[model samples]
Target: MVVMMSPFKGQTGFKRILNATGYSLAGLRAAFTGEAAFRQLLLINLVLVPLAFFLDVSRVERALMVAVCVLALIVELLNSAVEAAIDRISLELHPLSKNAKDMGSAAQFTALCLIGLVWAIILLG
Candidate 1:
């Protein structure tokens, strides 16, 4: 069997980590600036996440709460990536493009629903 390594894996030590960090920051900036949904979620998280720490949750519960919220942001980033890729491919209407975008949105929605359910169950149940 043959194994494939990431092109990024060639660089070792602190410089590689720095480059990866820079790439991540750039991606985050792009998502925040270019995607309205991403921006909205970040703002909402800014308020909700810190508030989560002050809740009466146990350590595990608090971690779970914050994790789900962060998952929503991750899903949104993926959705934005899908939309951007589709737009890059073409600006015209196409069924496949719509499907790709909608599926991305559906994934994000599912993640968000999970976040809501976690908070509700842990806090209210």
Candidate 2:
């Protein structure tokens, strides 16, 4: 069977990197503009990541602190993407659709909680 490729798929080497970076930046912009939760988490990260750098913690602690926040942001992006995909499939209510969206939301919540736990343990310990 023949396979179709993405618009950016055929490029190689430096061109591929440029295309990929453009796509990534576009995704980030879309997330910031379209997803309110993502925008809020990004604002939180803007504060937390800088604080992580200036804290008295060890390098590992700083890294972990920053990483957990980034993880939450990443998870939120995935959650938004999932919600968009499900909505694309149909706007009508369905148990499976509810389950998929709920699970995506749960994943984002877990990641956010993990970020909180990491920050509290590192900053308060």
TM-scores of the models, in the order given: 0.88, 0.89
- Per-residue alpha-carbon lDDT of candidate 1 for residues 1-125, written as tens digits (9 for 90 to 100): 99999976898899889999999999999998888999999987898799899999999999999999899999999899999999999999999999999999999999989988999999998
Residues 1-125 of candidate 2 have per-residue lDDT tens digits of 99888875789999989989999999899999999999999999999999999999999999999999999999998999999999999999999999999999999989989988998998888
Pick out the ten consecutive residues of candidate 2 with the lowest summed lDDT: 2-11
The whole-model C-alpha lDDT of candidate 2 against the native structure comes to 0.94
What clash count goes with each model?
0, 0
**Regions of model 2 farther than 4 Å from truth:** 1-8
- By lDDT, the best candidate is 2
Model 2 steric clash pairs = none
